[model samples]
Target: MSILLIILTIILPPLAVFLQHGLGKDFLINVLLTALGWLPGVIHAFYVNKR
Candidate 1:
């Protein structure tokens, strides 16, 4: 993961995944998680970005 992704993940999880992987399952999951709660989205974004 890059610094920008790390920062974006904290501020906007879905956006971070969108930047890395675009509109797909990961992005969708992040969006849902973000809608539910900020922390879950952040964690999922980090996990997705790392892999």
Candidate 2:
């Protein structure tokens, strides 16, 4: 599940964030980051590692 989230993050950051954390700050952040730059979005989306 986590691996899929990470992969989704790389492809579509906002969707990945939504899947992991639902519709909240992270989703907003992902959208902003995706607008700013694709790489940043990916990084932020995968920032939440289940550690």
- All candidates: CA RMSD in angstroms? 0.7, 1.8
**lDDT of residue 9 for candidate 1:** 88
Cα-based TM-score, every candidate: 0.93, 0.82
Per-residue alpha-carbon lDDT of candidate 1 for residues 1-51, written as tens digits (9 for 90 to 100): 678778888999999999999999999999999999999999999999988
Mind giving the per-residue lDDT tens digits that candidate 2 earns over 1-51? 567776777888898778778898878988999999999988877775342
Candidate 1, poorest ten consecutive residues by summed lDDT = 1-10
The runs of at least 3 residues in candidate 1 whose Cα sits more than 4 Å from the true structure, single-residue gaps closed, are: none
Candidate that would win on lDDT:
1
lDDT of each: 0.91, 0.79
User: Which regions of candidate 2 are displaced past 4 Å?
Assistant: 49-51
Q: How many clashes in each structure?
A: 0, 0
Cα deviation of 5 in candidate 2 (Å)?
1.9
In lDDT terms, how accurate is model 2?
0.79
